[model samples]
Target: MQASHTLAELEAVLGEQVKKLRLSRNVDQTLLAERAGISRRALQNLEAGTGSSVASLLSVVRALGREDWLSLLAPATTINPLTMVRARRERQRATSVRAKSPTAK
Candidate 1:
């Protein structure tokens, strides 16, 4: 999705949506926070979209039974057939990083 607005706007929108979801589920902030294994303040911060840790967000999502939302952020991996074939052909037991630039050689 295009971000035409600021991150704060997005956070607010998310917070509102979460609030609606919680209401629909007939859950209170205290109960939700307890289920999420976080402090009430943290839950409040999340719902406000002010700023919170990824772990806190995840906990809240889980508590709300919205694990599907996580998939929206990070979908399952899929490999391109051509790239997979190339990788198989050039497979190595191990790889290491070079300390210096190739030009130094």
Candidate 2:
């Protein structure tokens, strides 16, 4: 999450993780791709986490027997934009109130 981190680094780290997990489970990339219902190229890109689709990611996770992984990453939508805006406004108001108050610290 650091601003200085490059996209290539992120992709490389993700690719490495996927590779590690796969090798640990003794799963080959070709077999993993087949189980994920994706092409080998798509699997490669996904493990790299670069220019990959949500659907493809989900498929790969499921192939890894982690069906709930995607849901955990992006749970079923609940909060609406209006609610988010209201929350932001409340935080801003609290911050302004604090700024106006005398503090012991």
Candidate 3:
């Protein structure tokens, strides 16, 4: 997918992909919608890329046995060793420098 793709375009692509997956599995919209616990219209909306709730999308994806796709949206974070070291070396308190007094004659 191009980085410049509009939201609508992306949605349409996603809907098309879902439709393709369903077709590959030989599942019809009615059966898939029933398995997903959503209305056939909801599935149609999702597959048509018209619009659908996140819940409906997730339900459909789960019904299709593709829940792993959701993990891609929020992969586990990995901490950088350099960032960790810098954080550990940060100063905990401030110290003021003392001014030298005039020397006695």
Which candidate number would show the highest lDDT if scored against the true structure?
3
Give me the displacement of residue 10 in model 2, in angstroms.
2.0
In candidate 1, what are the lDDT values of residues 55-103, reduced to their tens digit? 9888989999999998998899898898887777655566887599778
Regarding lDDT, does 1 or 2 come out ahead? 1
* Best by the TM-score measure: 3
Q: What ranges in model 1 sit over 4 Å off? A: 88-105
Q: List the residue pairs that clash in candidate 1.
A: none
What is residue 78's positional error in candidate 1, in angstroms?
1.4
Worst 10 residues of 1 by lDDT: 89-98
List lDDT for all candidates, in order: 0.88, 0.77, 0.94
| CA shift of 31, model 2, Å | 0.8
Task: Give candidate 2's whole-model lDDT.
Answer: 0.77
Could you give candidate 3's per-residue lDDT for residues 1-105 as a string of tens digits? 899999889889989999999999999999999999999999999989999899999999999999998999899889999989887866888999977778843
Question: In order, how many clashes per candidate?
Answer: 0, 0, 0
TM-score of each: 0.76, 0.56, 0.81
Query: Which 10-residue window in model 3 sums to the lowest lDDT?
Result: 96-105
* 2 versus 3: better TM-score goes to: 3
Worst ten in a row by lDDT for model 2: 89-98
| Residue-level error in angstroms, candidate 3, position 27 | 0.9
Error of 1 at 40 (Å): 1.2
lDDT of 2 by residue, 30-85 (tens): 99999889999998887776767767777877778867655775789887989888
